[model samples]
Target chain A: MSKVYTGASMSLDGYIAGPGESGFDHLFEWYFNGDVEVPTASDMTFKLSRASADYLTGYISQTGSLVVGRRLFDLVKGWGGRHPLDRTVVVLTHSVPEGWAPADENFVFVTEGIEAAVAKAAEIAGDQVVGVNGGTIARQCLDAGLLDEVWVDLVPVLLGSGTPFFEQLGTAPVLLDGPVSIVPGDRVTHLRYEVRK
Target chain B: MSKVYTGASMSLDGYIAGPGESGFDHLFEWYFNGDVEVPTASDMTFKLSRASADYLTGYISQTGSLVVGRRLFDLVKGWGGRHPLDRTVVVLTHSVPEGWAPADENFVFVTEGIEAAVAKAAEIAGDQVVGVNGGTIARQCLDAGLLDEVWVDLVPVLLGSGTPFFEQLGTAPVLLDGPVSIVPGDRVTHLRYEVRK
Candidate 1:
């Protein structure tokens, strides 16, 4: 069955990005910390530990589509028009941006809301997993009771203050079950938790 | 050599305690989720999973002393004159409290600062680990570059906001080494990380 899940590489203090939108070096260190190479859909390839590479192999193979917030769509310039995962991306925004030529089929813009965005992504995912990027969209899915799982690549660095991976959740103190999975990688501990409905 | 370490049962969002001093019920749910009984110095006994029991068995046996803040000292009423771990406690405060009769050997009040409190704890700890409770004291130790390790019993819950386990650290980004150990409990992930000097 296709499931709705959000994932991020977070610092020890729960931050995905450090203060002033910084700390990517520490957060993304694991992607380049090892010897094994895992090529992505785009031009980039991740060098990861044997454990992390295997973990990502399963994760990448299982994920078919992704849902993201407008902020992220603008940040990476639409991941250079295609996400690294090489799957369809549903972006939730108030309105579609002005310029986009040839209409890339992989980029989907849903102005409706979080539910609509997730539904669109799920439709594209089918039997595979719908990967949701961390931040506002993830929190929205959680608030709407649409999120099924949370994957935290728990990094060891501590960014004292920054943008949290999970925060301002309307339904707070949300109880999750089982780190259904725990993989200790080079500088990251991959932890997965199922959100209890 | 005695190691200086700090620990806490934290929510997924990095809070040691929830807003308004709440959310402890969720944070501590792991302590009683299983059948194994782990008794403490105080009347309270932790009902834990076999994994958590063994994790604590090793932790308890290795800890000889503790360092805490004045706020915690007053909050637990000095833990009824004895801490749960049954170890000597060094309280960091600006001044001694109103009255503490007969001078309980287990409770030592340090009116100096964070360094003094840790030094006193180290002196008392001798060959075992000096356990520092989470919150201000733990942050202070990190700021002073005295903390050697961090142990987080990562609970599977999210408190929107609360007192952070580590915050206000003078050093913005403190890079840590290995998780060293990762022990998965019933509802908690017993994680240990070495603080890179």
Candidate 2:
């Protein structure tokens, strides 16, 4: 069995981006624009990088597969073909995308919906975790009762529009496991959450 | 001169509403869930209510009247009718809707450009500040450069889609005054922001 973790950064007004699929320039600018009182640059960079690295490595070490939606996949594919997670990547969609896997041998496109996607991802991830990689995908897993934890980097900008991390997730209360950490910055505030199963 | 305070709660991923425009029931739940730890019940209620009251009063104290968008007017016109700051209210829209204001003496209707509306509102407000209520109205003021300050309450919940508090404002960076308070909770978090000038 594997635990699923959904992680992403969002603006203050609940928009991942502004009206259109705007670039994250404003969001990132607000985050990195301020003078943080974190003591040293080495310490700051180490903490930020280590947290992301640990999150990524934790999943991979646990033999977790990556779950992403089509939009996210297209976005990443356009980012100079850089695939951050080098593992079994499961894409949630209806029909398999044309040339979705590209030349990446580690890609496994799952279009059978949220539950089946997680079951397959769990099978492949055995003894590890499943990294819920996008908002829609994560919410789908959550709505389908599969997600285990949700880690977030709470940015300070109020976007006021665009795609959200959790939309139309139906009506159900999610129990929080515990508080992991509160990484504060001049522009962004980070918090981690574990889902209580 | 009138000052506009922008306020709303947001999740770590920047979602204000989960999805659709079902009145953001999830957000209301998250907001009243009381995730943030306050010193005491009386203190907490007072602080929260006072904040809203202060914001409402601060603007109306200077502005003799208020101009709200249709959606906001519909949402809050009932209970807000008798709560303290009982003054003139105007609903702004492209085409005037039926029954725009509460059945009382102080409400008016404006169906024109923001510039005209504000000019008239200013006259009516006199020395008092014109309190612009709701997302559409706020954006109109922002676009017209009529806003002085914005106060946002960053609540934790990702409504995938709904009326954004800032959909049309684009991506201009606003100055963040400070993190006034950090209220924690399982289903929600509260953060306050003041617009820089």
Candidate 3:
């Protein structure tokens, strides 16, 4: 059975994206600029410690598929049909975009809902892990009790206002099992929590 | 010299207090309920591990004074004149409360502003640590560049909508130092960060 998890780089103030900012420049600078020690599959160089590199590479290698929201898909312009993760990508949206033809056959579009998209991703993932991207998509999975884990790379900068990762989740409170891991990176702290049933 | 620090128990969603709730009932349950292991002074019983108890008690013992917002002060009714930390409490507000009389002589009401309240608290704190309580007070201190550290006990429950600790901080971004420490409690994860100068 594949577990569904969410991974995002968020500000200490709980924002995934800041106002008037594009390309998640500040949020992802640590990864691309070699500020933190993380393992990368590409030829890009990183300045991470050997231990951190190993841990990050290990985590990334386990992802078998990804489920993304329409907002994130549009922001990245569908990743030009291929993603660095080298896994199947499922986009959850209301309607398919016009002339949405990808050079790669791994892109999937699910219009039913988040649950259906997650189900499709999990099916494609098989025994591996299904990674959920974007805050809204993760929140939807969380509300439906479909998420197994939430990994947050808490950045040091505070973006006063922008896209908040957690919105009005209604009346009932959602509980997490444990902060199983808290790893410190260059300017970010990586926190992992298990979403309890 | 005394350093100013802000501390609060917040939801993973970054809320300090929930709607229609008072006295931080949900946030401080672990401390009052003895859910985790913690050391107690004066023979007070705690259900926390010795290490956890020591860490918590040690942190509590370091506070010489506290700066709180008017809203939080009203919610706790000024803690009935006595606070659990046994430190001087300064309430920041526009005007003094009517018929304000605390049984303890440690309570002081500062009507000028957050800066004045903090200055007064720092004077009283002297060579000890001045603890800032409540979201508004902390935010004021953060914006004014008066805070030294921020300790957050990240509770697992998500409140969706409530009193958010971090709000629109204007154009400039406030950066924090490393999460210096991340300690996992029974139902909470304690994180400590130094406010960058």
Candidate 4:
């Protein structure tokens, strides 16, 4: 009953990132025209976080528990120690930081696989969809056939190469249920799709 | 007062196409879900064409002139002579195609400088926007500051690298009128941005 949603931006030719992730700055520089309409809630430091929040709220009103990868966790941590998620956030990783747990009340560092993490999140999420927020975790869910929906915000910039969010997928085709388009501003495009086996 | 509405997809770190364009397939693949509730009009091919039409029509709807790069012209020609734009299509190139004329007063070929072709397109489009369909010509317009607007439907796949759609561009920034997100099915996410400045 719980739907897993995967989302990210890609290139015109279908690449997630270029070699060593070069040219990202160039691409960002091209599309990095900051939104002129200022947000009423947050500053630019967590602009992406703010955007992601808008995305998460759309499907699952509130994620009882959220999960992320270690790298992504660290990135979020680096954002001036801002834990944007209001609910429990389980960082799925092997290594746990010394003082990371002290950062928040709902933050949990889990070494278990995505399934275990999702199971835990679902217990807390109840009837709501379990929000999977990391690239690796989302792909793992997709591979495991656990995701019920995918929301990709495909930004219109291409990085010649880098760490691809989604790579070689399973042979079996995944079907669509419904697709909708939303415009946050003239800069960001939101594409939501329901997944089917 | 031509507004350049630019559109393209980038990675999390922000790269348009990876070094060699290896990841473009994923981006294209995301758009296709065999099953979905979307109207047939929202098909991938139709949406791509419509976005181009919308951006072009926003400017020169009255004129039926199109300016594309030779590569695009060749690419389209290979598709069983299915020319999407049946107007005066000026293929901007040094090498002119032999016996290539206006396809029933709708498609015309031009092998020359971009300025002449676009100027002619402006004449033909009259109050309509000259629909620039190819990446090279689009980039040329961007570099020359001639493009009024660009409508980019950023897909959710990243090509680590490829022949960049905007390789000629430096670190120039464009204004985002904002973007709309269209998620069709589970894989494809379409984002359209209105070009400003």
Candidate 5:
């Protein structure tokens, strides 16, 4: 079975995006601060520290599918129909958007909810990990007990206010286990934690 | 000159405290979860992991004084009149409390402003570091261009919602220099980032 996980580059104040959809320039600075090249499946390429390059490439290689929220899907226009990771993306939404369908252009819409979407993503992922978006979708997966891990690229900037990493959690205090891996990168700390079963 | 810095044990979701003033049990778990002893000036002694103990002891051993907001001074009843760290505390408030006075029982009340409070604290600290409380006091120091560093004991739990660290910044996206030190403890990662001057 594919391991289900969620991750994001969160600011020091725990925001994934600052208020009014801002602060990406600071939160994602690590991707552009160093000299080593870490290219996506598409045109975007990241200049990262050697350590980040090693960690990111390994992460990208292991992720086979992603389960994201409709909000994110709409935000990037479905990642231009091909996710930067070049994997199958299962979008959990109330209804499928117009002009997009199932399993075409690397996008799959799931109206059945988080469980069904994650299940489909895991099936598509096979042995690879199912990467889910942080915040809303991640909270749903966590609440449903389908989430196995939480990976965070902790950026150093304090966003002050913005969209927090996981908001409105069903559980008040969600205690997690070891950040099994702590890979220090430029301007970001790649921390991977195991969700308590 | 005393180096000004602010720190707190923050949740993975970037909250210093959870909603309704909750979540300290999860946030301060690292302080009580270790075998090595790190004693403070007061009767309170923390059992910390060796790394955390060393890091914390070194942090505590430096000659210091704390500058904090009136709200925090009132919160713990002035840490029971003697702060756990056993250092002089400068309370920044609009007016001194009804009973407390200057230079008495390790507590000094400063009603002037953030600058005067920090200045008094710095005078007391001398060559040592002048520590500021996170959140309100820290924000003032940063805005005043007085804060030099940020120390965070990053815990693994996600509080979801609560008092965020450095809530409002006069300057958005305050760029920091480095986590010059990263010490991993049993359940906490002690991170120190230098504030850009």
Candidate 6:
């Protein structure tokens, strides 16, 4: 079965983005310096180390679809109608735009709820991993016990306040196992873990 | 010259301790389990790998003194009057307890302020590294640009809400350099960073 996972690059203070920051440029600056080699779904340039690049390459290759939030979809203007992952993108929202048009056969918008969105994404993903993006969507999946893994690229900056990566789950503490891999990049530390059953 | 550094074991969510938790038993549980070798001043039994033990042994041998918050000092009952670091411990507070006796001529309570506590700690630290403890004190020192390095043992736990390790600094983002070393212990990943000047 395909595993469901979430990933993001966050600051030392666990902020995915700083206040008033529209994009993740600052949080992801480490990827652009042309030193490390990591495969990203976006067109943004990145320099990732061989290990990081290999890991990302494997991750992207294994990801069959992605689930994201409407806010994120709007931030990048629907990723110019094509997401970087090149996989089918499922956008979870309260309501679909009246004149929404599919940029490609891969873009999907679900208004019912995160479960429906994830279900649709999983269906599309088949035996491939389903990737969850956006902190809100990720948290929702985590709360629902629908996520299987979490990957984080820890940037060494204290944003102090911004969009927190983790919110109140209202559930008992979640235990994660294995930083299966801890890759030290030039400006980021990559950590991977499997959600304990 | 002695460098002032802050260190703590934090959750992936950036919480130093869970809500209502009195001690770091959960976060530092890995240290208590005899497995990886790490140097500690306390006689508490430990099982450490040669590398981790060496690293810790070197670290403890170089630490000259420690600065901690009153709350933490009270929590451990001043580590039983003598701290594990085996170095002078300065407790920062607003007032000193009446008739407070020196735990062993090494415990000092500074009612003046963080500056005074840190200054006194530095004096005792001399050319050896000065260690700062507690989230509040560490944040204060970081904000004041008095901290030179930070070492964190990242534990894989989602403390939905708790005592956050980093708080709003009300200043621009503070950059850090290095994971100088990333040691994946049985239950924790140890990370070291040099605070960028």
Give lDDT tens digits, candidate 3, residues A1-197: 58998888888777888877642666775675454544333344556544345556767788889999888789878766666666788989888877774323678888999888988888888888999974778888888888899888788777777776755564346667667887777677777888878
What's the C-alpha lDDT at position A1 in model 5? 75
Model 4, span B75-132: residue lDDT tens: 5572334334344555677765666553335445555576776776777666555767
Tens-digit per-residue lDDT, B169-194, candidate 6: 74658888987877777668878888
Which order, best to worst by TM-score?
1, 5, 6, 3, 2, 4
Q: Lowest-lDDT window of 10 residues in candidate 3 chain A?
A: A35-44
Better of 3 and 5 by TM-score: 5
Q: Give the per-residue lDDT of model 3 (tens digit) for B59-133.
A: 877878888888877877766666656788888887888887532367788888888889888888888899997
Q: Is candidate 2 or candidate 5 better by TM-score?
A: 5
Q: How many backbone overlaps does candidate 2 show?
A: 31
Could you report the DockQ of all the candidates, in the order they appear?
0.85, 0.20, 0.59, 0.10, 0.75, 0.65
Per-residue lDDT tens digits for candidate 2, residues B1-197, read 54544445433443344345543554454434433322321223312333443433343356566776667656665334432346666666666556544234655566767776677677777766666654667777776777755544444343445556666664454434445555554444445555555
Ranking by DockQ: 1, 5, 6, 3, 2, 4
Candidate 6: where is the Cα deviation over 4 Å?
A22-25, A35-43, A47-49, A101-104, B22-25, B36-43, B47-52, B101-104
Give the per-residue Cα lDDT of candidate 6 at B187.
Answer: 67
Top candidate, metric lDDT: 1
Q: Write model 5 residue lDDT over B35-152, tens digit each, in one string.
A: 9988776678899888988988888778489988889888888887789898999999888788877667599888889999999999999999998988888999998999999999
What docking class should model 2 receive?
incorrect
Ranked by lDDT from best down, the candidates are 1, 5, 6, 3, 2, 4
Model 2, which residues run further than 4 Å from truth? Answer: A17-21, A28-65, A70-82, A85-88, A91-113, A123-128, A158-161, A167-181, A193-197, B9-26, B29-67, B70-81, B84-131, B154-160, B167-181, B185-187
lDDT by residue for model 2 (A138-187), tens? 77888777877776655655555566767666643344543466555545
- For model 1, residues B1-197, the per-residue Cα lDDT tens digits are 47899989998889999989999998888889899999998999999999999998898899989988889899899888789888989988877888874236888888878888888888899998999989888889999989999999999998988898897878878999879999998889999999988
lDDT of 6 by residue, A1-197 (tens): 46899988888768888878733665786667556655445766557666667667777889999999988888788887678768889989877755676334768889889888899899899999999984788889888888899999898888877776766675647888979988776678889989898
TM-score against native, each model: 0.97, 0.63, 0.89, 0.61, 0.96, 0.91
Candidate 3 TM-score, C-alpha based? 0.89
The sequence of per-residue lDDT tens digits that candidate 4 reaches over residues A41-127 is 224422343454455345435445676778877765734454444566667788677666633556667677778777766766677
Which scores better on DockQ, 1 or 4? 1
